[model samples]
Target: MSLLFYSCNSQKKAQKKEAETHKVIQKKYADLLNVSTTEIKNVRLYAFIEEWTGTPYKYGGLSKSGIDCSGFCNVLYNQVYQKELPRTTKDIAKQLDKVKQSRLEEGDLVLFNIEGKKNAHVGVYLQNNMFVHASTSKGVIISSLENPYYKKAYNKGGKV
Candidate 1:
């Protein structure tokens, strides 16, 4: 029984160590991405996508507890691409160069603004016209760009 108890303790320690290692790795990659090093280690942006999936949404928030639309984009870009972007959807809307939606890559950011309306929301692309966002009520979730709501409100997409 003592042996089993020791093993359990070891396992917990190993899990804790692994979690620490992940933070180190994430920080290292974020640093590289921030510098725009010619070679990016993780082209697997999807790997990063799944990290923040399903976080609850909140106004004036930029963390897992809750997050707004532009807050989602800001966090993704800063963490994945290591670029600090403007936090407000409106600021992000005008900062990036426009790209055709058909050509959007995984790291590209999407903006949704109804016709004749100012940009009010943002999200990160996943693929197949899918993006991830923290909605006002839906929280952090993957969304279909082709969804009727997003389709009608589509503004444009941009690469960081």
Candidate 2:
């Protein structure tokens, strides 16, 4: 009877600790993204994006040192969604369900036509119209879909 009580107590403590840790993570992301912590529905995904915030961009690269837009998307999907994706923007786009930009949700892929090529660039959409991508000149950064440059280059959004 004593052991049962102890087991229940220990489980309760563990759950409490987990809740507290989740709160901390929520607060951290809320501050970083400038939104309410309650708006953060997926803490692990938020943390994953935060982890690569400042990585540099490199064509055909796939690590912290450098990563292209599609490479970053591939890594994100593989790690956060446990799904493997095609390595190139065109290929990735082919695998995803086409979605209108107005309907984009978190984790959706935003396509761009920077060089007039179909799906020339890709970024992972986050909440609030923001998306993270490996910019050729600025490396990895978050930009708004409303940005004039992106607006002009916008192609579509995709859901895997």
**In order, what is each prediction's RMSD in angstroms?**
8.7, 3.3
Q: Encode model 1's per-residue lDDT on 31-64: one tens digit a residue.
A: 5334332233354454565566778888898887
How accurate locally, in lDDT, is each candidate?
0.75, 0.88
lDDT of 2: 0.88
Relative to the unseen true structure, what is the C-alpha lDDT of residue 64 in candidate 1, on a scale of 0 to 100?
Answer: 79
Task: Give the C-alpha lDDT of model 1.
Answer: 0.75
Task: Give Cα distance to truth, residue 45, candidate 1, Å.
Answer: 3.3
lDDT of 1 at 91: 82
For each candidate in turn, the TM-score is 0.69, 0.82
Give the C-alpha miss distance for residue 69 in model 2, angstroms: 0.5
Badly placed stretches (over 4 Å) of model 2 are 1-25, 31-34
* Local accuracy of candidate 2 as per-residue lDDT tens digits, 1-160: 9999999999999999978878887897677667898998887787787789889999999999999999999999899999988999989778879988888888899999887688889999987788889999988888888899999999889787
